[model samples]
Target chain A: MTLTHLNARGEAHMVDVADKQETRREARARGSVHMQAATLALLSEGGLPKGDVLATARIAGIQAAKRTHELIPLCHALALSKVTIEFTLDEAESCVHVEAFCRLNGRTGVEMEALTAVSVACLTLYDMCKAVDKGMTIDGVRLEEKRGGRSGDWSREPMPEPAAATSRDPSAEAEKPAEAEKSAAISPTSGVKIQFLAELRERFETAECVLEWARLPSRDIAGVKLALINQDPKYKALLNQRVLCARNEAMSQNEAAVAPGDEIAFFPPVTGG
Target chain B: MKIVINVQQDAFNTEVEQARLTEGRSDIGAIVSFTGWVRDFNERPDVSALTLEHFPGMTEKALHVIAREAGERWALQGATIIHRVGRLEPGDAIVLVMTASAHRRAAFEACDFIMDYLKTRAPFWKKEHTDSGSYWVSERQSDREAASRWEHS
Candidate 1:
């Protein structure tokens, strides 16, 4: 028979670490916040109003590391040595990459602390910008690396340092159907999803003016306007050179034809989440 | 060995867990598991279902790390966890935490520890889906009160 403070019930308790040795332990984890290229661009450009998204998120991550146990029951409290969060701009997809590394000297590893840091950082980003970008998502928050404990310095990936991406080259790969599919599969609102419908509307409506495409370096640039009135001799030379990525699903054979005086609205697809 | 993380999933099982936590032991004294199910009854009645989203990678890592921490603090032979994701309904197993130890004290300690971990650390955002529309879960006094106890401990 089990004689203990808890039975089969939902209760709160801290993990007892009175007997565990205090050793130097550290945990490094990485998590990402995937946003629309437009959203990302806005973030990078400091268009977000919550006052420095990265700065606030970084501070939030550190605070989260220190409060891991308070937020999680059964987690033994320990002295955290260091908690650092970094952000990088991925120009390709227009997403902010948040990475957190947490260190501690205690009986157990700091994996939770590190993970907590990343999660809070992402949440902080969401909170700061949800007013403008509610569809933002946090994904792939995994242990990039860790050290100490019986497992002995284990990690699923390299000891990733903190960074983000901002505008890669506009390569032909941007136009590949497969790349668009892959981006949608990972997180449906990036890359081509953000711009497909707008492109279709512009093309079919014979809409005048420059059209911003979701081409490479997408996060670095906004939608361009095309002037349909002119032969657009310049745009003719740039055909298929660029594309738009929006926060929606990929277009299925983008085709649009609009009669005179027709108005078209392009919006991001509604996500299940 | 019992693990708990804050996230949402449809189902979790215990029978299948016994094999996982006690795989090595005929010597195990007792096994304890605490499974938390999504109750159909909330403060509101019209709640048809709920969907939970989380900082994916961070959520799992937080759970694993919490579970491992509990195991180290309390002597446990083994632990297992099952956390669900995506849309879920009432009566769904949101979390499953089980612990095995040489004696009941350790098992019980580990089990309690895991539940506590679930309440506080996991980065899951809860949305209550009702006939009206989707609403974010407001802060609950009970959860804060429960978690508050550990803050001082």
Candidate 2:
């Protein structure tokens, strides 16, 4: 069936929810920002020049939840009853985990408000810390759970362990030490290098695929993936799935431009709560 | 031109929005409205619900820009955009776009133009949930193509 936002003529309109029953709705969302260890230290120590980073982010998130209707064009105006933003410092991972909760007694659910709060909080954190670490990455934004509304209640399933790091293919495991040594031997040079991460790393035993400047004429993500697949056809099926590409440790699209000496990585979609 | 943009987690009353657009405006001869609802399935048939996300400061700015651009291209008397964000079940309303003008053609075209631009330019993202897992919905190539046509037109 076509979406209700679209009329029979395929035009967009707001749905009339005056007849729907009001219910107490609550939702929670989580995301994380990964940064350098030094940057994390600065954050934990409250040494950031921006004063208190988490406090600022928490306020920004709350304000963002209140203004959600302003940001999303089709959202109805809702008076959110409660909005809370919390942060957890994972020192071992050098990451700050953000969680947002939103509540409203309305006809619709509050998941978006919660998700938006988490996203803005993460972005605010990035802005506050960019002076110290410009390489931080924001990822794993998703809805963790929701309650109330016509859908009853829903919760996300626990994510499986990343296949590449955990599931050791016996044959691949036996050869990994030698392959790791080979990868370690190849010093960083003024040439294109491709690395498999997470599950992809386990699938591709070589770990790193270093290419001479002459061989990497087309420095696009698809070209790099194609080159890797050419070296080993076993990656054909894996590459066909929805794999994320990154250039120089930043998330990028498949058509993103690449250059010599760039570090490229391919990994499965990130799943974190 | 009158433009109204709303973003909230509650469902909106289309009748009220439509009445507000045309109320006492004797000059309006035609009103075009569009409503989008959540479908149970996308890419897969098992989707139980959807979670939508948007950029806070940026989404409203983008929607206003699109509404203003539509006003410039068409002689619209009134326009309203209401988008919902949060968890939604099958058959739940997702969005509403309405346009009013002195003539049917202008109202129709303006509404279509706003929607096309909103789909691509808006910062909203959708994530579909199934029994086993949930995944962020990727923008379809067709949506990009649909929005690009406006650039040339």
* Alpha-carbon TM-score of each model against the true structure: 0.37, 0.39
Per-residue lDDT tens digits for candidate 1, residues A51-106, read 57778889989988888889977676768877778786775756777877777778
Which runs of model 1 end up more than 4 angstroms from their true locations? Answer: A1-273, B1-10
DockQ, prediction 1: 0.01
The most accurate candidate by lDDT is: 2
> Would you list the C-alpha lDDT of every candidate in the order shown?
0.59, 0.75
Over A177-273, each residue of candidate 2 has an lDDT whose tens digit, in order, gives: 4543354346345367777654556556657778654444344676676776666788685466567666764556664555557887665543210
- For model 2, the stretches where C-alpha displacement exceeds 4 angstroms are A1-273
Q: Tell me the interface RMSD of every candidate, in Å.
A: 13.7, 13.5
Q: How much is the lDDT of residue A215 in candidate 2?
A: 46
Residues B1-153 of candidate 2 have per-residue lDDT tens digits of 677988888999999999988887788999999998888888788999987765444457667768877876777888899888878889898999999988899999988888888887665767789997886666677776777888887
First chain TM-score, candidate 1:
0.53
How many clashes in each structure?
43, 29
